[model samples]
Target chain A: MFLRIDHVGIACHDLEAKIAFFESTFGMTVVSREVNEEQGVREAMLHVADGPNGSSYIQLLEPLSPDSPVGKFLAKRGEGVHHVAFGVPDVAEAMGELGGKGIRLLDERPRHGSMGSSIAFLHPKDVGGMLTELVQAPPPRT
Target chain B: MFLRIDHVGIACHDLEAKIAFFESTFGMTVVSREVNEEQGVREAMLHVADGPNGSSYIQLLEPLSPDSPVGKFLAKRGEGVHHVAFGVPDVAEAMGELGGKGIRLLDERPRHGSMGSSIAFLHPKDVGGMLTELVQAPPPRT
Candidate 1:
């Protein structure tokens, strides 16, 4: 049902400092940056490596407001892996399939995600402890 | 230094049930399973997807003893992501490089990990509240 790991979203209190640490310490590179108002996050995608399907990323997320999801995550759990997104062909289909199996979804339908992707989240409680995301990338530009 | 995410290790109280969850819900398949005495955990690597570099996995770890590291994690934080392992060409070199950057090391030297890999862990405190592992996979059989 899934393709590969799209990205690992990390909740960061200080996105700049954390990005620097990943770059200087781990030698990772930043491929893209965006501020998603709907998601209430200022995020950057750090390139982990290149491969056949596509490049994987370590996504650093800093909430724009304290009431946002990432903000709440940092307030409760501090800095850590927030969620893991698996690449899917269709986010809506994946959501429907999982929901049919008694899984709780945070999003009723696909929502806009970073890099023109459609995404929906599964409830962490129902996922056995980890917040899971289903991401479907937009078709390649002609 | 790091090539790609080797696996995301998740702490589970019941490995059987969790593996079943991934299989039934996400359609992930178990690629490998192992019991590591030194790590004090029974682990199974579930295939997330395949790529040029290799396949990524969601590793489920169940502590053999309550006193083990995974056990302590479950007791304190409940079931969730235990650690994220990054693939590297040389475990010792990666350890030395990170150590030189003042990042504390949980293992002074590479030790046996699940599936005959050389692995060393980084201190979670220094790593922004998430345990990190550097993994050097065994060479391909000739």
Candidate 2:
């Protein structure tokens, strides 16, 4: 099951400029920025506000390659929301539950996501044209 | 200032089917359902999960007429995300701030939204093709 919304992924042509826009225009905070080579994007997370589920973030993603998924999304849709990620207690468990439900899974196993979280995506075509991601936060350090 | 993500507005041709999908597929709860004649849409808010800011919703919208905004969106873009609503203390104040900042607002004054929330929209053309909404919740009952 889902715990809360993890973040909303926004595709951008210029990550820094988008970050500046959100900061100056919306008064958001840039909490972290990192490059996920596997996902083929450089991304930044903007802290929207504190919530009961925790602090929800708006993730700005700039594709590292034109052939990447985010890059293709940008090319087709221009710049906009690429996906909505929901926070789950466990990605593997959720995947197991969703399997064979007529929903297509993008990953067979949990993969690394931004901020050390586990992630898996559901095909947009299978989920009403919205690319949805299931996210599980990395276990806290002992 | 924004508090959290209030809801993600999703355009749908069949409101009941979409509501059922969220309930069975995502296991979300239907918190409220209303018809806003002014907005020309029948909408149902699905509670995704509780969070620190309170709770976030997935709002399913079905147009009342073919000429309505939601209807136009469905006709052009098919079923998908319509807008992302961010929770604000006051929508009018946010409009004032966003005005003349290259962001064009759809509402000059706060308009009646589903569940008595005051809502305003920012044009997608001005915001990188992503329609954004500012929403203020209805005041609690005495």
| Model 1 Cα lDDT, one tens digit per residue, A2-86 | 7778888999888899889889988999888999999999999998867665567899999999999999999998999999888
Model 2 segments more than 4 A misplaced: none
What are the per-residue Cα lDDT tens digits for candidate 2 across A29-50?
A: 9999999999999999998766
Scanning candidate 2 chain A in windows of ten residues, the lowest lDDT window is A48-57
Task: DockQ for candidate 2, please give it.
Answer: 0.71
Model 2, range B1-142, lDDT digits (tens) per residue? 6788888888998999889988889888898999998889999999876655556888999999999999999999898888998889888889998895778988879998867789999988776578999998889889
Error of 1 at A21 (Å): 0.9
The segments of candidate 1 whose C-alpha lies over 4 angstroms from its true place after superposition are: none
Q: Per-residue CA lDDT of candidate 1, range B8-56, in tens?
A: 9999999999999889988889988899988899999998766665557
lDDT (C-alpha) at residue B26 in model 2: 83
- TM-scores of the candidates are 0.97, 0.96
Score residue A6 of candidate 1 by CA lDDT. 82
RMSD of each: 1.2, 1.4
